[model samples]
Target: MYLIAGLQPPMDMRLFLHGFQDFFPSKAWQRTPVLYLPLVAFGRMTPMAWEELDQSLYTLHLPTPVTLRHTGFDVTLKRNRIILEATMEASVIDHLSVKIRNLAQRAGVSATRSLLPSGIPLADITDVDPSVCNLWLATHRHRFASTEEVCEFTVFKTGKNRENTFQEVMSDYQFADLFTPPSELL
Candidate 1:
């Protein structure tokens, strides 16, 4: 968690931050770790942009701000650009990221990285760009212990019961080898 205060920006920007803090107090913001999406956009932003994002997230049935353990978006407006910093769990990040990308696209902002949406075709797992493959592995890392487990899950998502070439897939994509943490850390 990081503070948004410095010399402060123009009056309108200050007002926007003030209003935002009024709703989602600074204490809560500082206590939690913030996860940032790979998207960046330039241009003036308003309270309406935040409201629209809130309304769109509401449609997704996510928990309210009172429960900050799950997910939320914090905007960091610098110069003439704004970055949507997301705080989320691995389980929901993929879904939220796709939605955020769509919203950014509508606003003419391009995402630096693209994530594979759930239910992607099995063939795409091998065909997608390497960066996309890495991002996919990253977003799913928390739920899986090893590449084999991820391969199993991916096959399951594709409506298949098994994958005989787990090694081949894992090697080709370089999801890399899993690391076993020190026992004390665990």
Candidate 2:
């Protein structure tokens, strides 16, 4: 962070503190593999090189572009009725059913508030599709971008056979201390 901000710590003798836990299964020292490096690698002056031999059981790439089947959306304003819909190869309702009536209300449609549900009720959801996830988020976000400020919703299944979710990234960073690749990966 100091390097990114172009600032140095107050003194060279300063130190940082990380709590110690019994299950912290990472090493204090690890090789700086190109694949193991931090995300700032996006526009690095050089390219990366690697083999699965350096594969990490503990780490993963960030913002991995998970894919979903191609999808489409439906919209209508009939007989003064408003409708919105979408479908996809697979369904995960993380942001599937959002109501834009607030937009209608702002546009002078007062009755829209009572007609639209708090949000759409999703009929189906399966696994998390990274690509689908990205698309759904992008479209819906763009729709509400100007009308709503700071709006987002996320949903996982809430039925039988589900674990309580803290919704956090996994401990992949445990594979090493380095965030970027060694000269090899780069």
lDDT of each: 0.27, 0.21
Sequence-dependent TM-score of model 1: 0.22
TM-score for each prediction?
Answer: 0.22, 0.15
lDDT tens per residue, model 1, 27-74: 323211211122112123344553353343333322211101213333
Model 2: lDDT of residue 5: 5
TM-score for candidate 2, residues paired by index:
0.15
lDDT for model 2, please: 0.21
The residue-by-residue lDDT of candidate 2 on 74-152, one tens digit each, is 3333243332222223222122111222222233333321222122212122233445545544655422101111111
- C-alpha RMSD by candidate, in order: 21.9, 24.3
Clashes found in each candidate (C-alpha, N, C closer than 3 A): 0, 16
Window of ten residues with lowest summed lDDT in model 1: 149-158
